[model samples]
Target chain A: MKKQTCSRILPLVALLWGVGLCACGDSAPELQRYELRLQGTTSRFSTTYLSATAVQVTLGGAPLRTELLPSSQRMNVANATHAHLVAHFWLRPEQVREGALEATVVLDDFGAFEGTDGSAGFVDAREAPLRLKLQGDALERNGRAVIHIDLDRSIGAERQGSRPLLPHLRLVY
Target chain B: MRLKRQWLLLSLLVPSLAAAHDLECEVSINEQSTLVVREYPATLTFRQVVRNIHPTLPSTLQEATDPLLEPLGWSFTPPPPVAIPVNDSRTYEFSVTVESLEDCARIGQVPPSESVEFTDTLQIGWDQGMATCSARVQCVPADTFVCDDTLYVSSSAGTSTELMPLDPTTLATTPVSSSTGFGYDAMGLSHIDGYLYAISNRNLSGDPIPHVVRVDRVGNIEDLGSLPELAGQEWIVGTIMEDGSYVIGSFLGSQWLRLNPVTLEVLGQGTLPTTTPTAWAANPLDNKIYGYQSYLARMSVFDPYTGDFTVFGPVLGNVGIQPCSCAFQQDGTFLLYCYTSDPTVDALFEVDLVNGVATLLGSTPSLAAGDMASCAFPPAQGATPAVRPSGYYMIHEAALERCLASGPVKLGLLPAVVTKEDALRLLWSSPAFTLGGEHRSEEQAARHALARQTLTGVCNQRLFGGTPELQRLLLDTTTTLGRTRAMSRLERHLGEANGRGLDVALPFSLRGRATPSHALEQLQPRSSP
Candidate 1:
């Protein structure tokens, strides 16, 4: 009877321990995630490098603080606009397990995508890139990043030419 | 003399205040193609629809007027931290979390412990130049981006100084083309080979249908002529093909047509993939096209070659992915930015062609432009060809303050696609006080609206053989559906109490540096001054 009681108590304790571990780590991770990517380019009219005063990125409903290379720390934009600009973003690929995503980029208080400037209709930007992608985990060790510099479109002003501002980010995980 | 000129300049500038002005809204998109912070409040469909629906009457609340929501189910307040932009016009969606979706199963409706009345402030960024190739963009932390002014301008206003900080909850208008190639303005968007397709329209007695014209963007305007093939079709929906071909579509006929970019001649024609194509995106793998055709709740794929099509995605009764744009990533995966009949807050879906599954990447109002590269036919998936928002907008005369007060305000609604064959055009108008349902006849109501107009008090009716302003208003909104400030101002100035006077109603370029009031004074008899 004593042996049976001790065995029964051990099983109950083991069950409780298993439950706690499941709650702590064994639970499923989120399958879906989304990110906001902001990219810039110059018009055919100019071949100068253009940079912004501030960079703010938002996703879902929260304001996401994105790391901008050469922020005020280094200078890619020298108080003037350039013919081209390349903004690179880093995001975790595992987050987009099985969900949806929405993204946008706007000018100060305005949606600047495909904007018609100086009373002109939206013009094709020769320097601004037209594509972004999330590199997979094993492929890119620093998480799936939205890269600005690709072989086709180099990031910089052909005149004062700057390569992709930040060569590579310090991979966190 | 210098002092006199300075005084003259000052006084001359003083009078023009009440002129017709523009209103613009800031918007953004995450990886999901959801529009955040829309200029107009009508974009609240995603967040509004995801609210829970009660099968039974609420014990705490009073009553339920429409039982339609009960049929449609709900999800947890869209997994919190999903920012939705709101305004007075569309705030009714916040307090009520319950919604009746089309195919909500067992857990259709749930009650929110607390009601979240959403509030958003417009964020402004650097305002230097204007013209751009695309309308909006979304970025990710999974990537590191450097912000600059040339390619990427910075945001200036809002607590968060991001340019046009858009919330993912907001939605945008469906893009339709009215190509009238008479290039006085900057509207013709399609670029194939050396020619640019434009909208060329005029209000002629027998000619109700506007026409499209192909003009050279870089050369003399006189060398161009009319494009007769697309003459009768008013709203010509189109995108550039892989081998420099063009695929133009008709929303009314649900017909797809292929044309040689050089000749503007129809190369091929086929029925539209969906009954109602909500959005259009280029196939990442090839020049094929994708549309939600939400009227059918399926992703209808279109091939420009034969004009043939295929249905992709689950046909599970109104899963309600109101497709925005069928954009793609660098690897050639399709991202269908979709919403629901209710504002089920926007979501991003990745179309897995291999398994035929539409995966959810995340949720957002817009997608990134960079995602288009390395993919097949980048322009089709939103390359430099993404139709960006026009710089200036027109506001209703009654909404002068909101239009010109500052930033983050909607100036006017775009003159999108208009159709007589079907009812898709009315989907973008203000849903408030709508006496009819979605399937209701918008044309009949417009006729009644025109019948009730009294424009005789104001004379000088010259256009359309001296027709009344009411008649002109309906004609422009329905027939020509254009994108000029003059047309927009004309639409809002009429049938409203507070108006931006007729003198100041002309486009800013024509009216010069005078204020609205001053401009109006100029229009008045010169002797009065």
Candidate 2:
């Protein structure tokens, strides 16, 4: 009679432990936050350099300033040496309208790169159409988006001397 | 021998009193464009330069001669006493008016043959001596207005595209009633004979046939049929001549055609020196067609009679951006509206034809980037009538003082004795009461009040001191036009009263002293004693 009682108590202990483990696995997943990165290549003949760039993010035509990660950056002449830039951003669930955000990036006083050698300067890239449509859900879920840009494909090839290649962007989530 | 020497000395002294001094006087009249049948306030500026040669004594200007300029009524206020120090010079500036210069030119004996030069003699007396100076003035009458100066602008955006009238002064816009249903891109616009004429490339059917149409003030449009040679031509610049004819030019070619504004019939055809004229307007001052070449950005003046073109140097402004339309102000300055890459932003420039410079007036927003047309209506003819004011009509403190001493100051229904305080109160309330709007600031009001007070004291002492008829006119209450109307009438009348002669009536003391004896005689006849 003592051996039979031991066997029934062991099975009951095992069943309680299994139920506790399942409850831990069924809890909600952790909330995600996102950051964006831009990577590009430069052309050898390109002399155009960006001094400062202003980035504006809008959700359905209204400007959104709060969630912009690293809102502004001073490029100076160091942009020519730096091949990559990282900009982090986050958006509230209510702020995302129609599941997208429009980004307009403008280069202020984008003129010729003054080389260390002190050569003649080239013309300025006064205005460039650098607009991007960002996915709201991916930025909210993944916590990171990496963009790849090709400088040659973006800018126009109108000038003969010291022409700057346009940059392209790619997203990796 | 002693008597002869004394007589010779007397002759020398007498001649010295009448001898001319080192003083010079000059008079000039503002130039005008044409002679009209109305009275224009032609400003005659008199400048006197006095050189005092007396080493120890300063020269004092005693009096100046008042010349009678008939036909053109002469009126001038006596200049203030000017003093020249020994061995120094002083200049006295006096402004006078020649009323009805146009009528004077048409009816005068010598009738202004060349540039309308009129000469009059002026004699000035100093404390120690006197001098006579000749005042020669050159004046040309300006062209009178043919119509009201209303600016018209056209739109081509949608079905609501229509012609609208814009106030030349205020830029206030109002839609023309007949601007509906006639949907086409207006390439050019002009006004003649109280009607608005427009040239459009697309007909009502949206075809590529160029047509000229007349639109009335109520927006009723009358199609004048297709332009013969201008079919399919997109860009056109045009202006209305003073004789009611239209000068239209094609941007795609060098051909310019003159047409009867009413018939749309091509009366004459000529070639523009430049290939593409982006904007053009008729300069009534010189009766030449002035325009801008789009390619060269140069100013070109085209003489319609000689068919000759005078191309000026390149205009200095925004490079490569051409004006979509241009119109002339009444003063012959060109107003240009230029096109920009951004559809919403447009630039307006005032081009000085004489100086060859373009000054940016301002920028207008929400205007489409394309070839827009504009036309300015001629200035309104006989709009401002010259009505001279009597002494009572002048509302300043000087007039008020004279009127107060004479009788009750009746301004509308409320008649009261006007004082200096009342004059100041009237001046303080002028912005609201006289101008009918809030057009003056507190600072401006204070400044105007101070100026009026100072002028009143000076003018009253000079004009109302010795005049009986003027005093009677100053106190008359029959000419009062109530309160509201009286302010405006008095304001205009006060403008005319400036620079008028102070000899309208004899001394009030002379008349009053004479009248008391007559009063005594009448009383003696009635008295029983």
Candidate 3:
């Protein structure tokens, strides 16, 4: 009788163990990871005091990262893919009167993301120089200007890229 | 062996069961913004929405995490860890108390700039993750120390000998014990060094004497002594100076006597420019005494150093009220309490020191003529000495520099130009020139030279041209001097110039004329002339 009981119990235990292994396999899998970074460089010859208003990172025309005044110092893009970064600045009146002009370019946004299977991610490795060129006289102008820094070009550069690729910043006003 | 295996299985099952049901909470506060006075507590209500995210198993909501709000003097009652049902949400409320202003500063929650919004966060935690809620608290410094700044009024009409304390802000009255044996008429009352000094009719002869007495806040009067020099003076107005001395002004002789605050003895004596000074107060901003002359209905500023009194202009309001009393605010603004016979108006006014314009604040409790005195608990520690610009040009230049340094320029809002005529009027009305005897002419000539220099400097800066600043300056000058004809002419010229987008200039012919006309003439462009 004891031999018969043991035989029945062994098969039941084996079935239970098989079911437990299947349940463990059905749990959610871990996510993947990717990196997106931006860097900006101001023109060495530029002497305009720049007050930035907006900094944003867009993925396929959709914003992945955005910051408004007065918190426009930095932006963080989460789960970013196919992203491009841009910043907006203005020439204030006091800057004109004081005759102390200067321009600042900021790598406003940085992001880390996990790519889905077969999805396109940030792949460019070449560090290209994004130039800021000033057109009009900043001291005589009063309006807005924009700086578009290519994420692929800013990948390997330092977070605060101070080296100027152009001679002057482009002032719309 | 079997028991050990069972115990191991039970331990694993227990943890899994506990982890299955987790709490999800969202915390919020009732008021987003509050203004708290120091040492005064303000209430804050916190509402927390707690939900059980478990699929099937029911779990009890346990204790929440510390909100870390102790630094702000915020405390909560009914310590957390209340139970919640599975797949259902429950709202929990808690009270937060802010103790003092010092704690508000320590918390570093106040905004740096005016109109800038600030938020203080409170974190509430459950079995799972934490949720944070924030409230904006704007802590304002309260005048909590103004308990001693009561307005003391003693009735001169009726037999009611009580010195009543009136709330300076509200004009509410509190009754005190009777001053039975003290005196009938209290002429002037001033609080100095925790005691109230009154110039009352408390002499042995029962005459209107300038007998000074010490009165406590509770209306207990103590006879200090009598001023022998002012023994028989009537209708005397007394003011306390910043140096703790009493300046008693007598209406009979038009004399001002400086008396020792403690002994009530005359320290020095001088004559006033005007005959009767009905109201007077020492301006803490400039340390100068200011008074209203009842006879002339003029506002005068007295320089204690030079013993010079300068009359600015006619007092703004109806000055028919006899025995009006004036007191100075910490900001140098004067408060005038007066009783008018016509319609029996007992009104309190806030006087603008710059223009002597009295803005009616409200009516007092009684319409009867009474002696008014004011005291503040935490007395004003006198602000930075304000230099009264001698002439209009000096004032204009200072205002211009301040406007430039502050922000964007608004040319139309520039200060009015102090013309030579305005300076002369101010100088001629001064006691130094009017009462200086034989030296008046010499002083006048010197002042005239100084005025010319100021005007020349201003003209060199292109401030006299057809600019918006000049137009506004001319309008203000005409309005202040009551130059009706000149004001009408200038207004017409200005309107025409503004319509054509042209600037106006002050004509050279009208430079030094009293009631100057042709002050605003259309300026030809520099390209033309």
What DockQ score does model 2 reach against the true complex?
0.00
Tell me the spans in candidate 2 whose CA falls farther than 4 Å from its real position.
A1-173, B1-146, B158-160, B167-172, B177-192, B369-529
lDDT of 1 by residue, B1-529 (tens): 9999999997776443211111112211221112222121122222222111122221111111112222334222333222223221111222122121111111122211011111111111111101111112111011111111101111111111111212212322222122222322112223122233323333222344444433322221221234555455533344445555555555466665565443344557766645636555455466677666666666677777666777766762424645344444435565555554545355556666556566665554332211111123322222111111111111011122222223221112322211210111121111111212121134433332222121211111211122122333434334433334433344333332111121123323222221211211222121110
User: Which candidate, 1 or 2, has the higher lDDT?
Assistant: 2
10 residues in a row with least lDDT, candidate 2 chain B: B512-521
Tens digits of per-residue lDDT, candidate 3, A1-173, equal 55555455444434432323221232322111111122233221111111122233332222222233322221222212312233333322332333322233332111111112211111111111222222223223323333333222122211111111111111222
Off by over 4 Å in 3: A1-173, B1-148, B157-160, B184-192, B202-209, B319-321, B365-367, B376-529
TM-scores of chain A across candidates: 0.28, 0.52, 0.26
Give the root-mean-square deviation of each candidate in angstroms. 31.3, 38.6, 27.5
lDDT string for model 2 (A1-173, tens) is 54454454434433422323221233322222345455444453233333223456666665553232222222222244543343444344544445446565554322333333333223223223244556565555555554434444333332222223233343434
Which lDDT tens digits does candidate 3 get at residues B211-326? 67666544545556565676656645766666556677766778777765554445568887667567777776776777777666677788665788887875565655355777
lDDT of 1 by residue, A70-101 (tens): 22111122122321222333333453322221
The residue-by-residue lDDT of candidate 2 on B146-248, one tens digit each, is 3544556666543335656544455455655534445444333443334455665555556566677665444545566676666646536777766556777
The best candidate by lDDT is 2
lDDT of 3 at A3: 52
lDDT of 1 at B378: 27
TM-scores vs. true structure, each candidate? 0.25, 0.32, 0.32
By DockQ, highest first, what's the ranking? Answer: 3, 1, 2
Candidate 1 at A173: error in angstroms?
Answer: 88
